[model samples]
Target: MIELKHVNKYYRNDEEELHVLKDINMSVEAGEMIAVMGPSGSGKSTLINTLGFIDTKFDGEYLFEGENLVTSSDDRLSKVRNQIVGFVFQNFSLIENNTVYENVELPLLYNGYGFHETKERVMDALVKVGIADKADKHPKQLSGGQQQRVAIARALINQPSFIIADEPTGALDTHTSTEIMELFRELNRKESATIFLVTHDPEVVPYCDRLISIRDGAIIEDRAVIHE
Candidate 1:
């Protein structure tokens, strides 16, 4: 579903050019949960930005479903980004003023769905994430786990080609984190949701089907995760 070839990213400061991503190449199949593990200053965020279509200032090929987007126009990239990728962040990124229902509905509305047309789609997503009961509540009224569930629901509402989760379980306690990871594992198992999980937590790696380790702006290991 996704491929990156000979990808390299550079940053400029003062009179120096620093290379960040180094010869990054990766391919993702459908319905796979991949854990991207890296520490600080390892170019992990840059890679995620590249894959999620938020960064196009790198040298190389980024092919999503066979179309190369390296040279696409900003408008074209925006369209593709909205239509193909769903992003979940550590902060949940929910609107505190909006009800859970409204928060999840925003994406559909942006995609051209009328308000009346969003109820079913919104409710279904909420239900899938085990948060249908919280639809009427605001973000501040919910616990961290519930809030993340809403975020996951919002991400799923689009049925995009994949979901990019960056530090998805970062804000919760260990128990809540486990619950969220289990939720993700179940989603991947039952609904075939393709997900790219960006986390520095080793505990988060086991829930994913594949493990990708990066350091010094390069992928050092790509392997399947085996539960034992």
Candidate 2:
């Protein structure tokens, strides 16, 4: 569903230019779950941002469903991001004051969905993530795992073709991390959702269909995972 060819990203600091992504070339198919693994400063986040169109100041062809995003206008990119891609950050990125239901409903509201449809989708997403009962709770009232589930629910409310998750379980305990990974696995297996997850945890790698390792701003490994 997505492809990056000869992609290169750089940052400038006063007098020097630092290359963060060096000639990165990658592709993700529909319904495929991919894990991007790398240590800090390895450009994993940069790669994810590039893939999600969050960082557009780069050189290369970013094709999503056959359209080249590199040439797309800001408005078009925003539209595509809102309609086709869903993002889950390590920080949960939820509003502290908003209830879980409102948090999940924000994206639909931004996308201009009507009240009835928004309500239905928000509820369904919460149910899918197994957090329907906490709809009225605020982010602070929930545990780390529950907050992440809410983030996931918000990401899924759009029924996006691609879900870009960055360190989704970074702050959770091992058991909770496993549960979150299982949730992602279920989404990939049953809903046919394409997921691009960026994580440093090896335990989380096995849940993905493919594992991609990056170092020095370039991909060092890309292979399918064999489930035992």
Candidate 3:
């Protein structure tokens, strides 16, 4: 569902240019759960940002479900992100003042959904994430795992075809992380959402259907695991 051809990303320092991604050619198919593993400064986040259409300043072509995302306009890109992409960050980017319900409903508000539709979508998302009962609680009132679930609920409220998660289990404990990973696996298998996950933990690799390892801005290993 996603393709990147000869993608190159560069940044400028005071006197030197930083090459973040070098000729990165990759493709992700629909209904596939892929884990992206890399060490620090290995361009994992850059790839994620490029795929999410958040960072548009780069070289090469990005195709999303057959559309050339590289040449797409900002308005078009925003629409693609809103309708086709869902993002989950490590820190669980939940609003401090808003309750879980409001946080999940914020995207619907921006998408111009009416009150009734927004309420339905939000409630459905909360239930899907198993956090419907915690809808009225603030972020601080819940545990880290619960907050992450709420964030995932917010992301899923749009019913996007693909999810991009960066360090999804970074802040939670091992047990909580396992729980979150199980939730993600369920979403991938049951909901048929293609997942592009970036994580530094090797322990999370077994949870994914496929694993792609990157080093020095290049993909070194790509394999699909077959479990017994």
Each candidate structure's TM-score, on Cα atoms with residue i matched to residue i, is 0.98, 0.97, 0.96
| Worst window of 10 by summed lDDT in candidate 1 | 69-78
- Model 2: per-residue lDDT, tens digit, 22-99? 998888889999999999999998898888778899988888888886578999888878878899989999999999
List model 1 lDDT by residue over 1-228, tens digit each.
899999999999999999999999999999999999999999899999999999899998988889897578888888788778999999999999999999999989888899888999899999999989999999999999999999999999889889999999989999999999999999999999999999999999888889999999999999999988
Q: Model 1's lDDT to the true fold?
A: 0.93
Q: List the residue pairs that clash in candidate 3.
A: none
* Residue 37, candidate 3: alpha-carbon lDDT: 94
Return the lDDT, model 3, position 76: 80
Better of 2 and 3 by TM-score: 2
Candidate 2 ranges beyond 4 A from true positions: none
Q: Is candidate 1 or candidate 2 better by TM-score?
A: 1
Sort order, lDDT high to low: 1, 2, 3
Which candidate tops TM-score? 1
* Cα displacement (Å) at residue 47, model 3: 0.6
